[model samples]
Target: MAECTEESTMCDPRHALLLQSVQSGLPLVHRPYAELGQRIGMSETEVIGLLSEWVAAGIIKRIGVVVRHRSLGYDANAMVVWDVPDGRIGDVGRRMSAFDFVTLCYRRPRQGDAWPYNLFCMIHGKDRANVLAQIELLAASCDLTDVPRDVLFSRRCFKQRGARYAARALAAS
Candidate 1:
């Protein structure tokens, strides 16, 4: 990969346009990269090369889809927070993340008496009862039966989209 610098990422006009096109999400079609290149006056190879360079240089952290679970028939979305022991959080988190039902799992710092939970995981299901059952299974599998935790279910759906770095840059220009 070629050396990546601040100027390489930001000074290139083509890169700027490419970033803007990607911000809204890649086109839903075969050969999306090629399509994006055509739109930005680049070849498919050039588009891939720049994106790869950005990822390798840490300019781009991740390239992934933001799934709308509700549209996929997953209506019961719950975030389960656990007050795991500090020393065992790593192991516990790994175990929790291994379950297929658990869509997301990570750790956070506890606040105070009002909020003592640290570990967190998101579980999406077709219904509340299914989600609750999966949580129970998770507790048993991770040996977190005695752990203090809470399940906060979603009351409403929110719009989900990718970051708009290029859009903001264009607005500022």
Candidate 2:
């Protein structure tokens, strides 16, 4: 068995082949992994096993759709950042995420006196008015109105893609 650390998780020819083939895309068929396996000369089970191992080894975070909200008719996307008391971040963040309008929520490091916001949430709606309304409602509902916060509505999307890591494997003859 080729354990993930056995040149399979990273810097392995086999792994590179798999990554390059799928970098463009996975097959659109029902059994995409199976299709990939067939193209890469591996059994479906083998493909699945390799993927599982890679994920466990942190070589892969996740494979899912990268939905373009604006293309999907959602014109309003606002990133709400909050500066809650240090002790309340976890509780406040979890509460903020409970709102149906809050699509994405996470925490980030705060820059002392400069930019104090640590918790962030993204709210998507049909339009700017709708998004602002949701944010107002969130403030009241989540009891964050008292908390220092700012809403940065997206002006335009510059880029959205998967992570690009520099090559670590030199081609082998």
Candidate 3:
């Protein structure tokens, strides 16, 4: 197998082909791995085995699907950040996450004065009014009505995709 290093711009040819095949997005088939393998002259087992090896070796970090929420009519997207007391953050975050409207939630360190908020959650809805209403509901239900928070609505959609290892490797080749 070929080796890739920080100084080396390329990787194994087979791995390069496999990465290229998946970079665009996996096929919408019952057996996507098998389809990927067939496209690159590899067997389903070979594809799965290679992916496993790379993962164990720390060559691949993660594999996940990127959903296009706007295409699904979820036009209003807001990231609601809050400044909860350190002692209450865990409880508040948990309660906030329990809501079906909150698709994502996590915590971050409060930036001194530049940014005071810590806990954060994402809410997506069909319209801005609905999203704002949901935020109000979240604040009331989570006992966060007194918390200092901000609801930032996205004004633009960014291209969502996975890593581009194949592009770099191909450029080097």
Give lDDT tens digits, candidate 2, residues 1-173: 22234543455556665775666667899999889988868788978888788789787777677677889988788898988788888887888888888898998999998999998999888889888888888788767789888989888888876543323342331
Task: Give candidate 3 regions above 4 Å deviation.
Answer: 1-23, 29-31, 38-42, 46-66, 163-173
lDDT by residue (1-173, candidate 3, tens digit) is 44477774345788788877877887899999999999989999999998888789777667676778889999899999999999999998999989999999999999998899999999988999989999999999988899999999988866666667666666666
Top TM-score model: 1
Task: State the lDDT of candidate 1 residue by residue for 1-173, as single tens digits.
Answer: 22234654565667778888887878999999999999979999998999999999998878896778998999899999999999999999998888888998989999999999999999989999989999999889888999999999998866666676666555555
RMSD of each: 4.6, 4.6, 5.0
Could you arrange the candidates by lDDT from highest to lowest?
A: 1, 3, 2
lDDT of each: 0.86, 0.77, 0.86
Give per-model TM-scores: 0.75, 0.73, 0.68
Winner on TM-score (1 vs 3): 1
Model 2 lDDT at residue 20: 59
Model 3 score (lDDT)? 0.86
- Candidate 1 TM-score over all chains jointly: 0.75
In model 2, what is the error at residue 82, expressed in angstroms?
A: 0.6
Distance from true location, Cα of 118 in model 3, Å: 0.7
Residue pairs clashing in model 2 are none
